[model samples]
Target: MPFPFRGFFLAGLLTLLLISSVQAQSVPTVIGARATLEPWSDPIEALGTLRADESITLSATLTEIIAQINFSDGEQVEAGQLLIKLEDNEEQAQLRVAQAIRDERRNALNRASQLLERNLAPRAEVEDTQARLRQAEAEIQALQARLANYRLLAPFSGRVGFRNISTGALVTPGMALVTLDKLDIMKLDFAVPEVFLDVLEPGLILTATSAAFPGYTFQGEIATIGSRVDPISRSMNVRAELQNPEMRLRPGMLMEVVVRRRPRQTIVIPEAALIPEGERHFVLVIHEEEDNRIERRQVQIGQRRPGDVEVLEGINKGELVVSHGVQHSREGDNVQLLGIASDETSVRELLESRRGQGDS
Candidate 1:
């Protein structure tokens, strides 16, 4: 069938309208930003755990059975505090015998030398007495050392773990008496990817928090960074020292850490302004004119914080960016500047005020 001139004109107009609607892009997307400046700080977040810097398993240096458990489990003990006492009766008895033998030998040697000087004893006999005295002295020292090994004393000031044996129980060498840990100063051990290696080093400050103790922030310093990165994880071990003078922090509590690498003044835009589609990211920048009509311009992005992203390559200062209603306008379409610039300013002010509160 053939259409008349009027019908053909009407069909052409409808087709044009459909094509334009399909190709239209959005404009006036919600926009906001923070004032920018030159600074050099990048904050890297990490997960770690609280741990004691020094921990060891207390064991008997010599073989013996457990006699009396001196310290209670999980008790804070001082340096050289009695932790465990083993069966040492046999050792003490032997030590007494050894002391007697040494004393007797020493006395005999003195008497023999006196007699030799007086020409009353043979020279060979005096020499034999001297030899016996030396042997006896050596035996006494060995016995005293062995006797000291029966009792286990805390090597350093720390908290003792569970008692591994009850009183009168028999234990041997290599048997674990208890665990001890010095928790006054804790080690915050964690790992960071090699990509961030340059930003971390000794003396840098850090703040950490734990869910166990809510709202309490802990402070620390970067004490060590491993020289080599692990091949499997491509991460290097990092250690921070935290003062736990009250001994309130436990040895294995999970932690969250934020290490500031670089601090720089930068322009930050609201995340709402960003329009992400597949691999590409963009934002609807505000185009102001004398007519008060809003227009759109695309922008690139950099890093992101809680609700803002850094402007890396796109946009500039004093330029307005439309954050809300970006899906409605186009490149040259006329838009009413529904609100004043103060709307964007208020949002930025809110974020800064919150940050200030945290600082106080």
Candidate 2:
């Protein structure tokens, strides 16, 4: 072999080694998201039962036969609306006789007063006539009161339940005739641990969901907090009122309630960005100014929500952290930015969207 040819071969071999090293150091592509300031809240969950704002069972106070049924099953009625008419023929006839007697007594009293003024009647006679008129008036009032007991009127504006009696059906004292409920607003009764008593107060916002109404969230505010906590459960009762103008909510419906508390703005990042090693969490943050190099950082985490986590420390707003391709990333390694994730779109979704665009 010639000496010059040997030297050229050695140089070529060196050049190839350098090229391989450069290729090995090539930046790996990764999906990342910026730590952002977002509104965060602590949620306290509980179970509750729904009740009507006002509810009552209509009943008869006296034994009587129903003469007319003014409403049908499940009818909406206004306050003071006549709902049932009981047989009051005897009371009505007695009232007419009493009224006539009162009218006659009043005429006699007026004549006695006139005679007394003319000195033709004694003062005692006028006083006696006045007493009789008073007695007659009282009798008429008593008969009218009795008649009132025969008529069943709605005490409040609400929807009526199934009628228990029909025309000519006899009802005794305390007999339930129907049910009435004001469903414009619903009351929810729930309990939370006594530890949350400090935060439990009227006007705290809550959201409720019922199995009977899937995907429908009922919004309400706490109306009252019980004065005492339950000794056995170590929980306090809470009552919330929900607007139910459509009457979709009914009494005795079981519901799941979540009360939001301690809301604040905090730094947040995608949950996928977190790498767990025992009790410690780490994230690979991207530094754009330094050729997109990653920095491994130990982070303190607080509450975690779906798809996102609260970053208590070790990150700031606008700092990008690797969300996808985290397994392939390490500290001080250069990375190629695939895309940035936003609150509306997750890292995996964003990667898929980018892939779709490339395919198009």
In terms of lDDT, which candidate is strongest? 2
Residue-wise C-alpha lDDT for candidate 1, range 286-326, written one tens digit per residue: 55654435545556776777756777767776566655556
Give candidate 1's TM-score. 0.63
Residue lDDT tens for model 2, 1-360: 799999999999999999998876666879888899998879999999999999999899999899999998999999999999999998889999998999999999999999999999999999999999999989988888888899989999999998767798989999899999999999999999999988777888889999888999999989999999899999999999999988899999999999978778999998999999999999999999998999999999999988999999999999989988899888999898888878587666877887998799
**Candidate 2 — which residues are off by over 4 angstroms?**
1-26, 287-293, 332-334, 346-349
TM-score per candidate: 0.63, 0.84
- Output the lDDT of residue 258, model 2: 92
| Model 1 bad stretches (over 4 Å) | 1-41, 61-63, 122-124, 263-360
Worst 10 contiguous positions by lDDT, candidate 2 = 341-350
lDDT: worst 10-residue window of model 1: 26-35
Model 2, 159: alpha-carbon shift in Å? Answer: 1.7
Cα RMSDs of all predictions? 12.3, 4.4
